[model samples]
Target: VGAGGETAHLAYNSGASTQHSPLEDENDYEESDAGSAIGQLVNGTNVLAIHGLNAGATSSDFHIEPQLIITTRTGGGGQTGYFATATPGAPNGRPETLRLPQTVTFSRSPGPFTGSFQLSITGAAAGQQIRYVMASPGGPFNADVPAPTLTSTLYTGPVTVNSSRLIRAAVFNPSNGQGGEPSTAQYLLLETGSGNNTSSFTSPLPIAVIDQHGGGGYGPGEPYKTSFLHFFNRGPGDIARLNAIPDVFTRISHKVRGSSSAHFPKRAYGMKTRNDQGENKKFELGGLAKANNWVWYNPWKYDDAYVRNAFMFQLSRDMGHWASRNQPAEMFLNVNGGKLDSNDYWGIYVLTEKIESGKDRLDIESIGSSDIAGDNLTGGYILKIDRADEDETAWQTPTAQAGSEDRIVVVEPEQEDEKPEQIAYIKNYIAGFETAVLADRAGNWATRNYQKYIDVPSWIDVHMLNSFALNPDSFRLSSYFHKDRNQKLKAGPIWDFDRGLNADVDSGAQYDPRQWNGTHFDMSWWKQVWRDPEFIQGWVDRWWELRGGALSDANLNQIITTMGD
Candidate 1:
């Protein structure tokens, strides 16, 4: 050892040694010096010196081999033995064979059926037995949790399922006392009209069936309830067609989401996929990239076409901006803990991706808690001007007048995770931008120019889209601004266009495209920037550029047709 040493003596011809032949003359030795010898092993390097006398052989025949053993136990009641290989003098082999039981397979796949069917589960070896558990219609069944021994039934023969239910089965080997991972299947009885009009309803879009356990409706606050989501569409290659078998079936925690839209009869939901232990699980849904957070947006009375939000987001992406990617889906919600029927049909909804910090989303650099100086502290933030929510973390901008609706809410990093330093940094940045905009209007461009703080092309694009659509909520609400590390502030990946595109007939001013939509509200930073001739010329130039391509009649018509279909 580097700093300490241990000593052990081997008796030459001790009668106490248990040996039979000349080659079997061996003695076992144990080191008892724990304080100095064990603690002497250093991290990087160590020197081990051996001093011994060869009593039976000459110096040329003297040889020795040492074997070390270490054992550790994991938190999950599992243990790992020695890390070294077995040698001629010392053996270090596993005590028992570790093998997983074979997976249980069902005779029929999970899907919708018209009548009762004979279900057979078959996947057991000689020492293994099958165990299964059944959940009533709309009941909870988590495949991540092992089947309970007291409640699980042993599979002895064929089981018949007549009504809708969920089944989970696993192969258990009593000899090894180990159970294989469980397999789950959902069966919906389509013949039972059960008030849910599943027999006659047909949809061109994918179908989403959500079954909430325990029957009480969703709430707007904390503590989302457990639920199951089954998505049905034509398997992989032919996604446009409808199929009896579901493409995605997993557990989720869901709750009512949105501000004013939460009161609508057709409810919107904030959902996240969860594993058996109720941890965040990511999955790709409807050809979209993998994500854990999702939104089921319900188009209410204001948007009769049910495509305003989707269309606007698509157009924003077409203009080279990253908006929320959404897919049309027909949803069926059952909160009664019974067989689903026509009453459960909740109509069409848009499954939209939630905006946040991800490579597939805003693509901003992540800021850690310790990144308080230099370029690391400069940016990668997402802020929005939205209605005040008691549960959200927001700051009042210095440029905002008292009682004004400019409560800047932090979107990325979330409310609970955002630090006070991050909030202060973003607030100071926005205040600087406002000061520069005002100074530019006052003809003081020598020091702080508005163009130095913001991405002018992004601002112009947002203005053109809002002005062209005559969106009443243009700059006032749901206005998003993001900045990446070492980058200028950029406006929008536009959101909440359900009231835009002349969707609200009562607001007649919104129907006219010539009307300045941003002026309907306080306008905030836009009002000061509009006063600059350079900004005005840039806006005009961008408008003409868009008209020649994205906003052209032919292009707009094609987009409308595609959305309509």
Candidate 2:
């Protein structure tokens, strides 16, 4: 467990062991250029890049691949192949330069509901074992201590890789734990022998990297860069119920030594009646006052915002993208380091309803910034990982993509060509930007009554929701990100004020529409929450699950825990 299957984006650890164990100690110090490699495809991949460089030596010693950090593996046998790097001081280093490949991507596995990818080492014969593992930033990691042993000694055939959305794969030689070359060479993936249809064709997954907007040159990279740091740093905060503080922090955080800081509040977000209490101030996390009062989102407890954002983090983790929730923090020396970006906003948390009706699951969409109603929860955003470092925003409207004005979060059609349209409608609905399309869907839902299924559709329609889009069950997660409707009295799942502050109408002032009729995130959101039981239940159950002991003492002591993870 020496830092294997972990991140290196952590701040300099005050308690890092002086002992240099290959598996534990050394692995913790590696790093990568995964963040830069994100290109236009996955701008939120900044976190992955930050981590790749941090895990240097251990990546080579134990062959422990950093889960989600970007490091592609490709070889011609007997020789290592080249990959992008981020090593500081090296040529093309510190963000993306030529380096060695440490991990392997999985080929798309073809399954009915779910899928998988397989790997193997090259030129290896049957019965010869090779160790491999797979993990995702959005998910968990799994390693093969007992490397896969090839039963067939002969080539049998070519190799095929499967590309699934669940996670990425990596292959390495484990030496059978016996420390000797086996009778034959082993392939890194299973597609060559018995797995593929004929082991002759190589079919990669038609991968789709979607909606990670904070960095894609389309949206703000500030908050997203901060999010990347915390996601990898905080690890996963698991929550179960309401009135309970969510443990937003996790084992992934790293604390800096001796950094004294001050507090200054500029503006208030995600609360009732936005205010500029000067309550938002900058202070060293180490010196911040402890929460004498119980926090609703304890670092130990996980909630829907936690889970939804967790999924987005995993996506960026695998893709080696960079993103964070807060502004990048600096040491007391006036020198900023470790993870975190500016304005303390990570990537937005996407919340989709799992509409189940007699064993059927439907699709719906929402964001970390949406307003919520119901009982346990009122109107406010959830699972937001604002960077404690940066405290400013340069907000603006979403890029003009087609269908940016639809408001009916619809279940993504199970057909091709229909996807873009479906997603467009959802984004508008989630943002509470419009309700025309939504009203069109369930037939004048403003005063409708529900007789079947659940209230998800109704809730969305009733509340002025907001989001980019929705899609699901497709080869990629984007298929699950668009809009759809459900049954409910008032629309909700609303919270988050960053998008409305001063730039646009929606976030600036809830009722005033100065710029072409804008949207607001405050009272307008809660106006519906007072009548919805469904909204209350979601928060109630979540807070109920994050009780005692599920949390560790180490987790409870910090203002943030991601830098160390």
TM, every model = 0.75, 0.20
- Cα RMSD (Å) between model 2 and the true structure? 30.0
User: 365 in model 1: Cα distance from truth in Å?
Assistant: 3.0
- lDDT per residue (tens digit) for residues 217-289 in model 2: 1122222111111111111242122111212211111111100111111111111111111122221121212
Off by over 4 Å in 2: 1-82, 85-423, 427-565
Q: By lDDT, who's the top model here?
A: 1
lDDT of each: 0.71, 0.24
lDDT of 1 by residue, 1-565 (tens): 3211222434443222222223444454333333447666775556565444443443354444444444455687664443222345654333323334377899988766666899999998887888888877534433223353423798999999987767788877676545666677767666344554465445667888887633456866545677778787645554432236677777788888877788887778999987644678888888788888999999886777888888788788888899998888888887775556766778888899988778887788977776667888876888788875666777776658212765787786576767778777877888888877777667644444767789989988887787776677778788888988889989987888877787875656654666643473247677776667677888888778878888888888988999876
Task: List candidate 1 stretches off by more than 4 Å.
Answer: 1-104, 122-126, 137-151, 170-179, 192-201, 234-243, 366-374, 388-391, 401-403, 439-447, 505-522
Quote the lDDT for 472 in model 2. Answer: 14
| Worst-scoring 10-residue span by lDDT in model 1 | 13-22
Error of 2 at 458 (Å): 8.8
